[model samples]
Target chain A: MIEVHEIVKKYGENNIVLNIEQLYIPKGQCFGLVGNNGAGKTTLFSLLLDLIQPTTGRIVSNNIQVNLSEEWKPFTSAYIDESFLIGYLTPEEYFYFIGELRGWKQNEVDEFIGGFQDFFNGEILGRKKYIRDLSKGNAKKTGIIAALIGNPQIIILDEPFANLDPTTQFRLKFILRKLLENKETTVLISSHDLQHIVEVSERIVVLDRGCIVKDIQKSEETMQELESFFKDKISLT
Target chain B: MIRLLQFEWKAFLRSASYNTHLFIKIILALAALYLVILFFSLGFGLYFILEEQGMKPFDVVNRVLIYYICIDLVIRYFLQKMPVMNIRPFMIVNLKKNTVINFAITKTLFSFFNLVHIFFLIPFSIVLINKGFNLSGVFSWCICILVLIYINNYLNLLANNQDVFLYGLISVVCIGGLSEYFGLLDISRYTSPIFYNMYTGKGSLIVLFLIIVGLHYVVFRFYKKNFFLDGGLSIRTRSVHAGDYSWLNRFGTTGIFLKNDIKLLSRNKRSRSTLLISVLFTLYGLLFFSDGLEVYENPTLHIFAGIFVSGGFLFTFGQFVPSWDSAYYPLLMSQNIQYRDYLNSKWWLIVIATGISTVISSFYIFFGWDAYVAVLTGAIYNIGINAHLVLMGGAFIKTPIDLSKNKNIFGDKQAFNIKTLLLSLPKLVLPIVLFAIGQNIFNSTTGYLMVAGTGILGFTLKQRVFKQIEKIYQKEKYKTLKAYKAQNNF
Candidate 1:
């Protein structure tokens, strides 16, 4: 579980990017975040990961202040972009490196990656290619899978499905569903795909500009409501 | 064609880093101006020096031309980036592919490597004419030299990434130098006549001209065949066998970091070049020791050489510490590792490399006990004090390095900026100045002890230094992450 209190991220004077007064992500929840371009989705994720300092406020991950102490790092993991992947390392090397950092033995790491054979599509491993040489979708798959290593309690992914193929997207959704089956794992995923967001997450939060506009428990008509809300915003412009 | 050039000009002027690029360019131009002045003086004075030796000045110059071309090729290989055409944007427009390729090839003719010739050749030709050589002969020879220089320029572009061309030329040069040294074969006897024939108004001028034209067409055709967006613009990827450094995992987190650092050095082009430069630096003491043991007694220059001899890796790789991982820094920060452990691993890596360098530099002991001691103490100083200074310097660095870019000496502009220049004062100068203070008050033995003492103190206080550096790193964490995210597209 994570608690964000009075988090305000500003670029300069008169430009507030993210200004969330209070946001809580409960344990074992499949939390989905939706936002348009420049809606501060990535900024919010960066603040939670402590990649950037909040102009005013703090983020607490599992009761540990992320900025003040590093105790939160062991239990939390995130893959926000290509910057998460080391370019020179092969996908296998990157996975093993991260696994080693999280205290997984080499054989254990190998056995863990073996479960993702279908997700890898046979193109990621045994290809003698570095992660940098892999295609964008494949690279994204590598980052997402690497973050799943070591069984972290909190996993964050930004735009996880953007560059993925349809098959891998479905596989990732299945993976998330299986992860949420446990009562302690909290998975936070941000996406632009509304349909996938509705199916994969039980709780969907919509952000417009810097404010959370809608926090709805998924229901039979949740998709229709989200579609109509975005349509009205477009027409108003 | 003119519009294509205009597009290139606009892109350059509108770029976000234009001011920084312009500043670096100005500095490079000033440094170049100094080199040109030195070359001009050498060329102008060459005829007089040869005359005093009772040798024919023109003949000697002709013989040396082959050596010049060989050296020029090596320098060009390192300094010249592949000429960028930005052809991707223009590919969709209404234009002939030939026109674009032709424009790219023609643009390469104005490269600094080609134009820098005028600085040396023009002065040499002026001296020949003043010395009363045949005017027409001098004219033909100068034109031939210029043509050969262009020939080298095109040959370099054709062989830019070919290891065969680079290594073959190096071996050939080494063999030729050795042969000349041992009196096996005199290359000048063969070269002097071939070039001297041009000065005798022979028809070799036509041959040289044809060779240059042939090379130009070959380069043009090569670029044409590989003009696709992904083919010519991207760094070529070769499948490399994964190396196993799992033996290092026994040391725990620092070992894991060291393993990753080794992969980084071996796999990236830019980082691999630093390894090559460090290997070269191990022999740097040769410059001081070659003058013999008596001249090597100058303690100041000995310390300078000793620093280079022992701290080769510290100076080249240490300066780029966290920037080496700038691409994946956020991943590092978000991971479960401690900051002190990260810095400790880097410190260990440097200490291990300096240990190797110091062992190799024990060859300097052949000079004298004093010479090796100077190197030994310098290594201690590097391990104890300068390692921390270098990491502290890295704490202030916010630039992200493109690890794959191998050409263009100024491509890694972070290597030459004002911050590094200011940091080098403490990293390089302070040790010698500290030793001088001790030596002036007592003996050279006291100075050496003083330098080693400071290193020992720093060695013992590693945790305290890391605590302070960790604070600085924590403060700059977000700012550095922002910079890397902004500039690092690779």
Candidate 2:
């Protein structure tokens, strides 16, 4: 579980990236955050991850203040961008490295990755090239897979479906859904694709500029309503 | 902690020599090890060498302990890198900031630069022990010196954190100057006797140890609060074009390329810091030309210092050539720009830099016009000959330098090595050898003419050299791009 309390991030005199008064992402929920370009989605994620200190408030992950202590690091996994990937290693080397960090055995990691071969599509592991040399999709897959290692209690993926092929995207959804079904893992994913977000996320939050405009539980009409909301924004633009 | 370091060690090794042929790494490692051992041996044999040179080893070293420690601190401050273990993955983990930072600090304590001073002290102490000096006191002195060195390491981190360490550096220089002046004047001979008494005094190391612990505490507090991966990675300001390089617009394709090159150097912290450091190094000529004018009697030393002073900007910037743009190299490669034009743009930047340095160093005319001509010849040769050699050397370098990391002067282990420094050695040394032979054997004018003639001939053959290096670049293009794409170095 993650709590953002009175979080306000400012860049100078007036520019505020996020001003969420309070947010609690419950355990076992596949929470999808949807937003436009300047919707402060990444900013909120940054605050939650404790990459940057919140200007006005605090974030508590799993009952520990994110800034006050690093106790939450053990249960959480996040991959926001390319910086998360160590580009020099072979994909296999990278996987083994993550395994070493989280105290997973080499064989366990191999077995786990072996299960994702279809998702990898024969393009990631066992490849001769370094992860940096992988195609953008493959690189994203490598990062995503690395984050999932250790069977972390909380998983956070930012723009995970972006830079992925359509097939890998579907496979990733399947993987995410399985995680959701576990009912013990807290999954947080942010994406621009409403349909994909709807397909995987049990609870969805919509953000505009730094405020949460909507927070709705999934229903049959949720996808149609989310689509029309964006379509209306487009017409207004 | 060991597990964390183990990962770092693996990254260090696996990341190195990815683009280089295996045989070269072996040879280069052997060569660097050989040189390190050779320096250690020189340290071991310092007493003998000083005796041969008619200097009293104990008298000199004892008297100049302050000078040695002070100068070493300044030099270490400039060149020594802060040991950084990228702690990003550990941040959200159960790992404590204390554990991570202490590992980084401890690792730095064992850095080659820190340990090098011991190489000298150990030998000197052995000589003192052999000479029947108080062994425990000598041992304590050595421990204190080593502690002081570690303190310097922590102090360097603190100073580097503050941006400019000029105050510390200036105070060191002023103290040394006053000490030397008074030490010579016999106006209450101060620093030498104080240091000598401190070293010979009993249990001085306990105090030294206390100072080190206090420093460690300060350094701990500093890194604990400020250590963040985002600070290391994030672009603090958007000034990709903060400076006006628009004057380069007139020079056609190469000019356009040069403008971008200028922007890259001005924008990126790593490259910009190196450029600023190189400019600071222009002051190095003062070290050679100011003192014993007798020092420049050795033509090899004189010309080597001269070239380094006048054309070092080219050397530093050119040696990394294409690697500087490795981050955006793929985009550059995919552009409609011609490879020759891009190469020429780099060449132009080096030439223009060399010219500015040569003119600045022309002030050496006060020392001797021959020295001035030598600086000019060095600049010309760097422009005409070593420029292409550097480009040729760049073509073979596969380690992509992180342009953005303000981490340190040398971004990563692979980005710079003794072998890369030696890449243009023959070109550099050939002029030195020719100038030496011509000056000492023939005449001073022949020395200047010999260097100048070589520059002229090389400038004439510039087209041939460019053609050769271009072929080399073509062969290396694909592999270079592959290596550049990887964040192999953390």
Candidate 3:
């Protein structure tokens, strides 16, 4: 479970990137965060990850204060972008590295990665080039796969579908669905693609301009509501 | 062409760390020019110095000519980058590949390095002319030397671009140096006559000319093949090997960081070059050990020698510290790794590196048993005291290194803080002073024991020192991460 209490993230003077009063997501919940650019989705994740200190209040992940203790790090895995990747390493090397960090045996890592053959589509596995040399989409796959390595209880992915091909995107949905089958698992995903988020998440939260604009449970007409809300708001801006 | 050159000049000057401080860049440029002038004067006086040192007048210039060329080739091999045609935009446009290739080769032709030989050969030739040598023989020899300089330039490019040529260059240089050192063949004496023959032998001058032309043709062809397709679109042969440093696992969390740091140092170009420079430094004996035994008698000299001898590579490499990982520092900071384990892994890595370097440098014992003792004590203090001092100093560093680049290695822009300079200073000076006082008060054995004793004290205090370093690192973590992310000029 993760909780944000009266959290305020500031950038210099008069610039508040995030100002969330209270947020709580219990374990096994697939929490979807939808936002446009500069919607403070990343800022909130960064705060929860303890990458930046909050201007006010605190974030507690699994009842452990994020800033004060590192208990959340063992269970949390995030791949926000290429910065998460050691670009000099090959995808396979990077995967094994991640597995090693999480204390998985090499054999177990190889077997787990083998399961993604269909997902990989032969573009990423056993590739000769380093992650830096790979195409953007392939590089994204590398990072995403690295994040999913080991038995991380909480998964955080930012813009997962951005650089993925249509097939991979379709495959990623099934992956998320399978991951969510474990009731004790917590997944926090942020995306501009409301459709995929709506399909995968049990609850969806919309963020706009450092404020949570909408928090609604996913239902039959969730996609339609999200569309109308974004259309009306984004057009006005 | 002028416009293109102007645009390139602007791009080069504007984008480079030239923007950091104009005063710094100006000082750097002057320093570079000063080095060239100093080396040129050395070349200019080399023959006379050899004569003074009691070599025959004629054989003096001839003996050193080959060594000078070899040193020049070696320096250029490590330093010069191939002039790449920035042709990505032009590739999709109405440009011929040959035009771009020709422009690139021409750009290389005009580099300061191409004219550096003038600094060496021209002055020597002027002196030869002034020393009542025959004009035609002197002219013919000058022509031969100038032709070889051109050959060195073109062949240097050949070595740069082709893997076979590059490896061949490295092997030739390494094997040649080793062979000369072991007295397998006197390379200087064997090659000396070739230049000496150029004075009277029209045959030798003709041969040198042919070789220069042949090398130019070969180098041109190699460049053509590389830039031939799509105007050098960078179609490189990529290969990846799986590295398993899993044996490093028993240390728990520290093992994980050690594995990553090893991969980081081995896999990346910048880091690999750092390792190579460190390895090359194992030859510090050839420089320092060349001194007389009298220098070894000074207790302080032993400490200085130990600093360089034992920790030659690590001392230089460790100062950069966590900044070398500035590329993925945020990822590291986000991971489950403790600051203690992170710094410890770096410490152990430097210790291991210093151990290996010390072993290789153990050959210094050939100088004397005293040299050997100094090296051992130095290694102890270096690994124990110096490593911690550097780690503690590194805690204050916020200048993130661009590990993704091998663009400008010699720009040597280390942000050495007062804390770093002051702390690491005692690693060298303190050992010397301690050894001196101990020797004066008691005897030489006590002094050696005191140096080792100081190292033991530092080693025992490591945990306490590490705690303070950990606090500093955590306190400055955000500022360090911010600085790292700001290095975006890939």
Instruction: Please tell me which predicted candidate would have the highest lDDT against the true structure.
Output: 1
Model 1 CA deviation exceeding 4 Å by range = B21-26, B49-56, B182-189, B292-297, B408-411, B438-443
Residues B155-192 of candidate 3: C-alpha lDDT, one tens digit per residue: 77766534455456667767777788898977777888
Error of 2 at B81 (Å): 4.4
Docking class of 3: medium
Indicate whether candidate 1 or candidate 2 has the larger TM-score: 1
lDDT of 1 by residue, B257-311 (tens): 9999999989887787777678778888877766756776567676777788899
Candidate 3 displacement at residue A183 in angstroms:
3.5
Best by TM-score: 1
- Quote each prediction's TM-score: 0.95, 0.60, 0.88
Instruction: Give the least accurate 10-residue stretch of model 3 chain B, judged by summed lDDT.
Output: B407-416
Worst 10 residues of 2 chain B by lDDT: B233-242
Better of 1 and 2 by DockQ: 1
Show model 2 residue runs off by greater than 4 Å: A1-237, B17-59, B78-84, B166-190, B200-204, B227-241, B276-306, B406-426, B429-451, B457-475, B488-490
Per-residue lDDT of candidate 2, residues A84-105 (tens digit): 6654446776676566546676
Cand. 2 TM to true fold: 0.60
Flag clash pairs in model 2: A73-B92, A73-B93
- Clashing pairs in model 3? none
lDDT of each: 0.86, 0.74, 0.78
